[model samples]
Target chain A: MKVVCIGAGNVATHLSQALYKAGFVITQIVSRTEENAKALALSVDADWTTNPDNIEDADIYIYSVSDSALGEMIHRNPRKNGLHVHTAGSMSLSLFEGYKERGGVLYPLQTFSKGKAVNFKDIPLFIEASNADDLNVLRELASGISNKVYEASSAQRQQLHLAAVFACNFTNHLFAIAESILHEADIPFEVLRPLIQETIDKTATLSPREGQTGPAVRKDFNVMNKHLDKLTDHPEWQEIYRLLSQDIINNHRG
Target chain B: MKVVCIGAGNVATHLSQALYKAGFVITQIVSRTEENAKALALSVDADWTTNPDNIEDADIYIYSVSDSALGEMIHRNPRKNGLHVHTAGSMSLSLFEGYKERGGVLYPLQTFSKGKAVNFKDIPLFIEASNADDLNVLRELASGISNKVYEASSAQRQQLHLAAVFACNFTNHLFAIAESILHEADIPFEVLRPLIQETIDKTATLSPREGQTGPAVRKDFNVMNKHLDKLTDHPEWQEIYRLLSQDIINNHRG
Candidate 1:
């Protein structure tokens, strides 16, 4: 199938490359920036265009733009003949109301970094469509790129994205906090890498609740107080520490 | 060298086994409970003792007890002649003040769970000693099991422990939070596994700050408000989400 990607950002770059590798012919790369569009189009062996009016006819137009720009982009590139799908977790299928028969979603439930190359097969792709025919087409296209594909409504995808913010994005911010803590103490962040890795690895064998350890779970107020004292200079972090500890204590309480 | 391990919890169990494998003879397993002491002793082919008075004389004594019990455990096992140390990150080397010449620390910077087998070679072992001779002994003993060994002061080790609480313990709690969120949405936790793994793997290539991506970083209030609405039932989580998102915004503000 001929595919045209609507953005050249992280998600678009990764998704378009994955789709191209999955035997789909990327006909054009339509992005706001000529530089990014040309770079991505060159990599995928497709034509690049910045004007929405210059968008080529394709079997699929995948809108991989940001949440704020998705609606406007859809309105600008109103194509009624092809399948119009978005790659957003929070957006509804109604965004393609003009092409109601072809509107769909192909949200990959994973965080994408600029230079990172993730294995598309392992990512869980959540798909939604307005009708059975479009849903089937999405199922086949999604299964072509990923082994784990699920049909989720827009509501479920939004919840999944929120859960992901906790699991992936917010969790990463915690790592950044840890990095800053270690930096203040002149301790190399490398020392905590193994511990961080083991924390994640434990999830394979035990549930997160079952694998919990450290001062918070033990209700060691002495240690917790000492840690809070250590973070006195950073009140925000202290609050985070206190709140998270209290939550852990509450969750484990009899 | 012969070693006597106090406490039969996760750290003591893992350390004693690692010492035994490294050719150090674990002479006895000492703890308050008879069953746990006996089980660990049997695994390491050592004698088990519940009574402090019956503790064996060994070249080195390693106290792997809780923070609250470490002081009393030191008082109970007063063997001024042998080398004494602890495996606690938050504890001070002064806990062994009675054995001033031989007191030291050998803290492994990692989270240990029951039955989870971690590669000791990769774990960072933080050691501290009052005297040069004892420090050399600790360095030798630590280097035997781990490729990553460093002499960290008591204060430095305490900070490392605090940092670890954020990086490992609290991070796992976030995963638990994510799990609960998915449960409420009727979504399986398995879908987040790949995303979680990728989040960690990104740390190897990009610093946590540079790798960060999400609505909080973008300051997308619309999506953030929508997520907050979704989390209306979870007041504590709502607070957490608000605080973390605010922190991310502040940190990224240019």
Candidate 2:
């Protein structure tokens, strides 16, 4: 199948490469920036275009652009006889209102980073389509690149996105907060890595609620107060500590 | 060296087993409850004692009891010639008051769950002592069990404990929240495993601040508002979402 990737960012780069490796022909790489477009195009052995009007006609047009740019790109690109899909968790299939028959979603539920090599086969892909045929196409395309694929409605995908914010985005912020705290204490962040790894590893065998530990869960007010006192200089961090601790306590309460 | 293990909880069980495997003689297992002490003692091939006074004489006394129990155990147990130490993160070396020459700490910086096997060599061991002699004993003991061992002051260790609360405890709580959100949507939490793993793997190369992503970092008010609206039934979660998102936005703002 021939595919045209509609962005040169991390998601686009990773997904396009995966698709190309899975025997799909990436005909073109289109982006607002010539440099990124050219770079990705060269990597995928595809032609590069800076203008959406120059997008090649292909069997599949994957829009991997940022949420803000998705609408504009959708409007600017010429409608072709192909499947139009987005990789965004938060966006709906209705974004392709005019091209209803071809509109679909092939959202990959994983974070992408530049220079990081991810095995697409291990990543879960969530797909949605307006019709059975388009759904089947998306399913086959997704299955070719990933072993884990599921059909989800737009509302379910939105909820998945929000849960991801808590699981991935917010969790990373907590790690950042830990790093800063260690920084102030002249301790290296490396010391906490094993603990962090063990914490994540426990999730495989136990539910997060059952795996919970530390002062808040134990209701050790003395240690909690001491920690609160230590964070006096950073009131924002103190608020976060207070709020998260209270929530844990509330959730665990009989 | 001969050792008496005071406590039979997760920390005590793991630490005692490690010590036994490392060729240290665990002379006795002491706890307020006979069943727990006997269970741990049976595993390590040591005698068990419910009475603090019955704690056998040894070259080292490893107190792995809870914070509330530590003080009473210290007061009741006869101060032997052995070096005394604790495995608690929030506790201070000064907890061995009046037994000045023997006071020390050997804190393993990792979360311990019952029945889960952990490699002690990978877990960071943080040690502290009131004097040079005790410090050497702790350094030797810690280095014997762990490749990653460091000398940390009481104040620094306290900060490390607090940082861990954010990194491990609070992070796990976020995972629990995500699981609940997915549960509401009839989606399995397994779908998020890859995203969560990637979020952590990124930390090895990038600072958490540099690795931050999602609507919060993007300042995408539209997606953030939609997420908040989806969380209307959960007022506490809404508060957490708002506070954490605001913090991420504030931190990323130039």
Candidate 3:
């Protein structure tokens, strides 16, 4: 199979690399930036291009652009595509509306950071296509790189995207808050790592609700008040502490 | 060193087991119930008793009780001569007021769950003592079990505890929300395991701020609105989603 990856961001780099590893020939790497496109193209042994008009004929065109840039990219859509696919969890399949007969989504529900090597096989790929054939093609491509592939409708994928925000993004924000708090206290963030690892590890064996701990889950007002007082300088963090604690109480208590 | 562990809860169970593994002789296990104390005592090969009064003359007495119950427990505080410690992250070291000369806090900055075997060597142990002699004794014990041991003050330990709420408790709650959202869509929660693991694994290499990626950080109101629309039935979850997303935008954008 041949693919033309139409972005050079984290997702694009990782996705294209995974596809290349899966025996797919990335015919052309298209990005407005010369360096990023050429760099990834060199790594994947693909021809690099700065213009979408120069996109090579391929079996699949995967647009792994940012959600915000997706609109700006829609006009630059590669014309010679056998099948059009995007790797966005939030986006609808309608992004490829004009090519309704031969388009779909191969959304990988995992965070990809620049310079970080992602094990695609561990990522859960949510596949959505307009028809069975396109989906099967995407599924075949996804299955080559990943063990987890599921058929998710646009609505279901959207819900899954929201869940990803909570599971991956928001949980990460909490970790950032932890780093911030520890930074202020002159304590190393390393101290909390084991606790964080155990917290995540518990989920594989226990429900998150059942695995819940600390002041919030127990609704220990004393400890909660102490924590709130400590966050006086960080009013935004203080507000978060209050809201999440309240929600945990309502969920667990009720 | 001789020890008496008061309480048979998660913290107590894990702490006592760790102490036993470190070759400390747990002279007696004290709890309000025979079954509870005996169960833990049997595992640690120590005598069990339902009375705090029966707490032997051990070198150190570790109180691993709840935050609310700590005050009530101080009165039941085992009268020992060598040293006294509590495994609470929030409580002031002054809780060992009467034994001020020979008491401090030996807080393990990790979440303990029933039936889960935590490797103490992986957990961070925070030691705080009112005096140098008591400090060394506590440090000696803590260092034996945990590789990551630090002398943190009452205030610093309190901050660490609050940070753990964000890193562990709030993170786990977000996971619960993810599970709920997936449950509603009839999707298996296992699909999210990889995403969750990566979310955590990223923290090991990247700062949480740098690791963050989502619609919220990007301030993509279009996608956020779509998510809110999908969550119409879950107003509580919707409110949570809005607040957290807004906070993320403010923190990252500012």
Q: Which stretches of candidate 2 lie over 4 Å from their true place?
A: none
**Candidate 2 lDDT by residue in tens digits, B1-254:** 88999999999999999988988889899988888998999999999999988878888999999998888888788855789898888988888887535788998989988988999999999999878888998899888889999999999999999999999999999999999999999998889998988888899998898999888998988899999999999999999999999999989989
Task: List TM-scores for all candidates, in order.
Answer: 0.98, 0.98, 0.96
Docking class of 3: high
Against the true structure, what is every candidate's RMSD? 1.1, 1.3, 1.7
Provide the overall lDDT of each model, using Cα atoms, as 2-decimal numbers: 0.92, 0.91, 0.86
Q: lDDT ranking from best to worst? A: 1, 2, 3
For candidate 3 chain B, the 10 contiguous residues with the lowest summed lDDT are B71-80
lDDT of 2 by residue, A79-102 (tens): 657899999989999999875358
Clashing residue pairs for model 2: none
TM-score (2 decimals) of chain A in model 1: 0.97
Candidates sorted by DockQ, best first:
1, 2, 3
Reference-based TM-score, model 2: 0.98
lDDT of 1 by residue, B1-254 (tens): 88999999999999999988988889899999999999999999999999998888888999999999999988888566789889998888988765435799999998999999999999999999998999999999999889999999999999999999999999999999999988987998889999999998999999999999999998998899999999999999999999999999999999
Error of 3 at B236 (Å): 2.0
What candidate 3 gets wrong by more than 4 Å, as runs, is A78-81, B78-80
